[model samples]
Structures are given as C-alpha cells and as structure tokens.
Target: MTCLKADLLILAGVICLSLVQRGKTKTPARVMALVMTVLMVAVAFIAVPISSMNTLTAAQDITAKLNPNKLDAEIEKIAEIKPVLLFSPKCPACKEVTEALAKLDPKGEKWQPVQSSGEAQEGVKYLKEKGYAGEVSYHRYAGGVPVLIIKQNGKITTIYGKENIIKAVTAPAK
Candidate 1:
C-alpha cells in the first residue's frame, strides 16, 4: 500500500511537471507542481518505507531517529500557538482521536489539524485544501497516525495512540 501510494504520488508529480513544461503556467498549476515536487523530495527522505502490514517497527525506527532539535524548532515554528494534531482520516485510530478531541475542543480551536499518513503526500494536500498556512511536519514525525505534538515549557512531547492523545490533551497543564 505504501509503495502504491508513493508511486501514485510520483506519477502525479510527473503529470504536474509535464503540465508545467507544456505551458500550463497558470498560478494554481504551477503551485501544485511545486508542491508535488517538494512532496516527492520528502518521500525520498523518509527514513523507512512503512507498508500497511509492517508499519509498527518502521514507524518506531523513524520515531527513534527523529532529531529533537530540528523537531523542536519545527514545533515552535508550526505549533507555537496551537498544538499540531497529525492524523489521517483513513485510520480508524485517528478517527477515534479526532472524535474524542472534538468533544474537548468543540470549535476546533485547541489544536491545528494536520493530515498525516505513512507517506508524505497527504499532509500537503490537506494543508492546501484546508487553507492552512502551517508547514507539513509529517515527514519529521511519521510514527503512525493520531500523533499529537505539543510544545510546553520549551519542550516537545510527541504523543501517539488515541488513548494517550486524549489523556495528554485532557490532562491539567503544569
């Protein structure tokens, strides 16, 4: 599944690039081409290719190899005001977390919703379609879906799983 998705993304990139080369220089098309190019680059950087059947260990390896300083800087830049909730609509666990969070933040004001997936392509589409101005940190923390990144006291806490996400968000702040 992961390979298929990646291949599809690459095909999309090729199509966009061909459009750009064939004089489809309108702003939206060019912008999409650029975005697709960047996403392809990010896909290349993914530490491990996580397939649907073998995601657990690969995601853990990616999580373990995460650079804290780079991640901290990204969190401060992207989620400085609202914590970033990285999720995938296709994931059952992510759906549960989103449902639980909706109860806490009825107006969706507590956290910034950023789409995530085993591949890096989903977040870019989510940001563009949602008109979100934040950056895609999915490639930075690809430890499965429903990952909530909270920055408190200048520290970054990456919480995974539906239950842990609920508990962390509902917990009393220090």
Candidate 2:
C-alpha cells in the first residue's frame, strides 16, 4: 500500500483502540491519555527519515545554481585559491551549489570555481582564457559539489557550504 494509506490506517487503529479502552476499562482517564500520547509520539518519531534527509535537502538547493555557459569565469576565480569545484551543468544539485558559491563573492582571494564540462578541451581553453593557471578536473556526479580546496603555496584546505560561504571565506587565514 501507499505511504499515505498506511498512515491513515495507523491513525484509524489508534482511534479505535482509544474508543474501545474508554468503553471497557475502569482505568483512570489520565493514565489512558498518557499511554496514547506515548504511543503517538513513538509512531511519529519512527515515521521520519532522519539520516539522509539533510543531505538531500542540501543537494536540492545546490542543484538550482549551476550555469555551464558562465562557469569558466567562476572557475578561474576559484582557481586562485585552489583549482577545484566539481560541477556538472546538467545536475540540479550542482547548479544549486554553484549559486551558493556565487553568493559568496570570494573576491581578492586565490580561490576559483571549477566546473566540469563534457567538452574538456574547450573547457580548458576557456579556463586559460579566463586566466586560470591550475589544472581542471572533470566530475560526473550529479549531487553535491566537491569541497573548495584552498591552497596557498604548498598547503591545501578543503571547505564546503551553502549558507555560510561568506563567513568561511572572510574568516582570517589559518
């Protein structure tokens, strides 16, 4: 059966149990109420999908931001920090992540955005034209964007964000 139908059946069963208990029991009404409350709470808790829900929500937001045609400029900028951002023009989640990154305004920093294109050679040419000196990496995933890898000289650090990219980018250099 469908999830909606199953939920309706569970609700009906709870109501029936409550009515039957009221008709047949001499038990205190307050005690019965507490038992019903506990059962409802347990059922509600079990109905939630807690583990991967947040990840999926984040991916949804990220997917809405990708723009393949404009990616070369963004990637060149991100490369200044470290040449890496895994992006696919066709992925909804990747688009959303790109939008989030654009909102970061990582200006004056050595960070550049990198988007993967099916036409790798053309993409490389575009990156070079935009002044990106770092190597371009191709990505096939349609979900989360790769972590932003910031490299200064020889040290490298990875970071990820949707809501707090500004805070992360503006924080004092470690």
Candidate 3:
C-alpha cells in the first residue's frame, strides 16, 4: 500500500517536472522542475524499495498475513488502558455489541469499542500498522469481529460473539 503511494507520487512528480521543463525559459518553471525533482528523489529514497518490483510485491504478500499474537498484544495493550471491544461496523452482531457498550459505558471509561471499520483484512492491517503502538507488523486478520479482550481476575480474557461480549461487558468488574 505504501509502495503504491510512493510509486504514484513519483509518477505525478515526473509528470509535473516534465511539464515544467517544457517551459524552461521561465525562472519559476525551472525552480518548479528542480523542486519536483528533489521531491521525487526524496520520496523514492524514503518510501520506494530498491528491490525488484516482483520481489517487493512478493515480500509484501508474505508479510500481509496477520500475526495472531501481535493482534492479541495490541488488544491487550488497549485493555490495559480500558477493556477493548473490537467490532466491525457492518456486522449485525458487532452492531448489537456497539449499542450495548454505548449504553453501558457512555463516558468511554469502562469500555473502549475500537471500530475495525472496514473488512477484516483491512482492519487487521490498520491495527498492525497504525495501532496503539504504531509500525508493528500486524497483517490482515480474516476472522470474526466483535472480540472483547479484557483483564479478569488477573488474567487477560478474550470473549467472542455478541452474547458473550454483552455478558462480559455488563458483568461487574472483579
């Protein structure tokens, strides 16, 4: 995804530079071309990989599989701050959980409902890459959502399904 953005940026910069170069007599145009060149170079250096495109794509595909432990760790971290409820917006069960949590913890203190807004894969990618601790190699999680992870009796407990989530969230803290 990032490489795709970099490639697009480079392409746009090249097009802009070419257009600017066509009018090289103007000082502003020359400056713009130089700026575009520098911008493209910087983006390439920072985002674009030096490896072959196939190699990069293959590597990305390999890394794109979600690491369950990382997902658990991320949820655990969120649970430390507040019990985390991972929900998918489009899911019916998740919707029920969301409503339950909304009514249960209006102040957002008792429960933190993290919306895994998009598809499961995208959600996992978002969580892994830009989660509570950013830049972690979290990948696509093609699993069921509405997962409630909390600390219960000194142990971290993960509850799945809408009924279990509702029960766990509503239960008195021990």
Per-prediction tally of clashes: 0, 20, 0
Best by TM-score: 1
Which parts of model 3 have CA positions greater than 4 angstroms off?
Answer: 1-67, 70-72, 119-142
Which of 1 and 2 is the better model by TM-score?
Answer: 1
Q: Candidates sorted by lDDT, descending order?
A: 1, 3, 2
Please, what are the lDDT tens digits per residue for candidate 3 over residues 62-109?
333433444556666768766777666566666666666666665555
All candidates: TM-score: 0.47, 0.34, 0.45
Error of 3 at 70 (Å): 4.1
Output the better candidate (1/2) by lDDT.
Answer: 1
Question: Model 2 segments beyond 4 Å from truth?
Answer: 1-83, 103-110, 121-146, 151-157, 164-166
TM-score, prediction 2 = 0.34
Q: Report the Cα lDDT for residue 108, model 3.
A: 57
C-alpha RMSD of each candidate structure in angstroms: 11.9, 13.6, 13.0
Summarize candidate 2's per-residue lDDT along 96-161 as a digit string, tens digits.
Answer: 555554444323242345555556565455445444454555644333454454555654434555
Using alpha carbons, what is the TM-score of model 3? 0.45
